[model samples]
Target: MLVDKVAEILAETAAEVIEPRFRALADGDVSEKAPGELVTVADREAELIIAERLRGLLPVPVVGEEAVSADPSLVKAVCSEPAVWLVDPLDGTGNFVAGRPEYAVMAALIKDGETVAAWIWQPTTRLGYTAELGGGAWRNGERLRRAPAGGGPAALRGVVLSRFMPPDLRTAVDARTGGIGTLAPGSRCSGVEYPRVAEGDQDFTLFWRTLPWDHAPGSLLVTEAGGVSARLDGDPYRVGRDVEGLLVAADEESWQQVRRELGLRPVDLA
Candidate 1:
């Protein structure tokens, strides 16, 4: 499939441009996009490479994290385009920059407000995940099924965005997860977290920002893997929409459990 070929390019890009620079960034290889938001030479190079290659695969518009960050208008363009490819060349920049092998390359295909395809590749772990809209998800080409239910507070594990929330909401959001489940050490990279949940290593993950490049691919991965995802408000994850947040679980049952425990209002997935 075209998506798989894109993944190959990403994996190769990661090997050539991203991995070599890991923990060995030069004086100018790193810079601040804004305080606490980092960008590296590898990210810029990788995206250009991916975008250029994707254009060859199809004429659709290609929007990347770095590109969209520089031009907010691109965000609008993406929202209105018939189809667009969204890329996060290197997620978990913090982890990658800090010498951790936690970042990844992610891409999603959005058409008519829906994400129909996604690819996420974790280079260090050599784990690759892909999903086609109606088809089930796969890891290294093996079919996947999210972990089955049973564990409650003691066995639960997931991602929580409270720490990244505003001061007022942070405390409340953090408290909401208290005692409900353990949070596995996050990669700080949706590329990893999204797959972790879908693969059943984690039970759920909540994000405060539903950026297309970040959540778009992962949302499809979790959902197609037999999990469920939506805005905390019960809206299904839609590409190109700047949503407040997202909640994904191994199953709808777990999704509701987490929402209720957090004191969030619930809506039926159907």
Candidate 2:
């Protein structure tokens, strides 16, 4: 299976490139790709290895995070190409650098701009999550099925990724957080956050930035696990779309409740 192959590739690449550098980065190992955005040698090297291995499996363009960072035009392949692979070599670089065990390596196979299969591998825990378009999601060979909807707004627990949100929107979301059962700052890693939502560890997650590499893998996993992953306006999440504000929850009812509680509306990026 392609998902199984990709999982193995991610795991092998992480073991060879990522784990060795965890908390052992030298002074020259890290640098800024943009203001406030960090990239490390491991991220670049792992991306190269993963991209190469994926291309070998299927001859398609690999729109890896580091590759897109180097060549912004490559991002267009995500939506324009018939088939592509989205790769996040090292998610949560800050946590990984700080010796936190919250980082992961993720990849998603997108066909016709929809994620068909995805994988998230956590190096520290050696946990691998895989999901296919119609196939269910799994963690370490165990199928994942989110608990049924049973919570109202006041009983919901969630995380809000507001760091990239507009000030007005952030203020609006913050005002509504008081209505939920529990709200915490996210793990700052979609690889971790998505699995948490799927496994019922968290009831919901609201993300302001909808980067394809970051959300593509996890969105499929959440939905495959019987969760709801959609945009603020209740649109299903599509890879390569330049939209913002995605809300993922344990079920459809919870998703709608969170959207209403947060007072979220369709974003106008223009």
All candidates' TM-scores?
0.94, 0.97
CA lDDT of every candidate: 0.84, 0.91
Residue 6 accuracy (lDDT) in model 2:
92
lDDT of 2 by residue, 1-270 (tens): 777899999999999999999989999999999998999999999999999999999999999999888899999998889999999999999898888999999999999998999999999888999999999999999999999667598888899888898898788778888888899878999999999999998999999898899999999999999999998777899986788888999999999888888888675343
For every model shown, the clashing-pair count is: 0, 0
Error of 1 at 239 (Å): 1.5
What residue runs in model 2 are displaced by over 4 Å at the alpha carbon? 267-270
User: For residues 1-270, could you state the per-residue lDDT of candidate 1 as single tens digits?
Assistant: 786798898899889899888889999888999888999999999999999988889889998999987987887756788888888999999898899988999998888778889999999899999999999899999998886555665567787866555576667767777767687656688998888889888888877767788998999999998898888887788875565768888888788788877766533211
Error of 1 at 141 (Å): 0.7
Q: What is the lDDT of candidate 2?
A: 0.91
The C-alpha local distance difference test score for the whole of candidate 1 amounts to 0.84
Error of 1 at 214 (Å): 0.3
